[model samples]
Structures are given as structure tokens and as C-alpha cells.
Target: MSNSKLYKGSLTTIILKLLNEHDKMYGYEITQKVKELTKGELKITEGALYPALHKLEAEGLLDVEVAKVDNRLRKYYKLTETGTKETVNKLEELAEYIKTMQALVNPKLA
Candidate 1:
């Protein structure tokens, strides 16, 4: 599902889930990690990513840390306490969504 609209709604949840697993990550790193995890099936663009990050930060769901790396400053994002709690909620919601989708997509199997 490369650049599929279906995944767009879950982007924030995906970001939260990744941060929950990794502790912290920079923007580019997040993009690359997603691609790696999905085996190139998904590619998250800068346009989609930054806005989501900014929104999450504004909502107090994330903390930002800046460190100089090889003469360049890199901003890393990590979940705040609220964010950690939110990750659980988001994941549960995703699971419910997946179940609903599965039931709809394959009635017999569900």
C-alpha cells in the first residue's frame, strides 16, 4: 500500500507506536524506519511527517531534544508521559479498527 490513503488516518498512531518502541528518533530516521518495517510498502513523505510531528508536539504528546551530530543539529522526538499513555490508547484503537476492517473485508473469516 505505497502512499495509500488508507494509512494516512493512522499516521499519528504509527508515529506514536514507533516512538514507544524506539524511545526516540529524528524525523528522517522515523521515515526510514517505517519503510524498513513495512519492507518498502510504505513511504512517509516529509510533507506528511513534519506536520504530524508538530501537531503532536503542540498537543504535549511528544518531547523534542536537539543534539549536534556531525556538525549538524538533529531534533529527536520522544514520547512524553502523556504520549506513552496515548500510545496504548492509540494502539488499542488501531486494533479495534483492524478488527472492524477485517470483519468487513472478509465476513466469513471474521
Candidate 2:
């Protein structure tokens, strides 16, 4: 599958799940983690990633902290209590989506 298409639907869940796993992470760290975990199958673009992060923050699904790291200020994101609940919902929804797709693609086996 094309990189864009593969990552299109899963970006938010990936981000949420990563935060769930790590407690907090910055933008670059999130991107790098996704790349490493996926073995380069996914490449997140700044244009796509930052906007989503901002949106989630606005929606109160994320809490952001700005701190000085070395020579620059970095923003780290963590799931709020609401965000943790939402992450569970999102993951369940994603799991259902995958199962549905699998059933469609392999009806006989299913």
C-alpha cells in the first residue's frame, strides 16, 4: 500500500497508543517512534502530524507541556484522563475496522 494511504486512517490511533505506552512524547519523537516501529512502512509528514496534534490538543484530548530541552523549547504531549478514555474507544473502533476489512477481503476463511 502507498505510505500516505496506509497511514491515513491510523495516524491518530498510532499517536494515542504511543502516548498510552510512553506517557508522553514530542512531535519528532512520535514520528521517529512510528517510523522505527513500522520499520519505515509509515512516514509521517510535518504537514499532517502537527495539525492533528494541535487539533487533539484543542479538543482536550491531549495535554501539552513546553519545556526547555537543550537549546530549544519542545512541546510534549500526553493523554488527559479524557484522552485515555478516548484512546480506548479509538483502539476498539480501529480493531473493529480491521476485522471488518479482514472479513471483506477473506470471506471464505472467515
Best by TM-score: 1
After superposing candidate 2 on the true structure, give the runs of residues whose Cα lies further than 4 Å from its correct spot: 1-3
Model 1 stretches astray by more than 4 angstroms: 1-3
**Global fold similarity of model 1 (TM-score):** 0.97
lDDT (tens digit, per residue) of candidate 2 on 70-100: 9999999999999999999999999998889
Clashing pairs in 1: none
lDDT of 1 by residue, 44-97 (tens): 888999999999999999999999999999999999999999999999999999
lDDT of each: 0.96, 0.91
Best by lDDT: 1
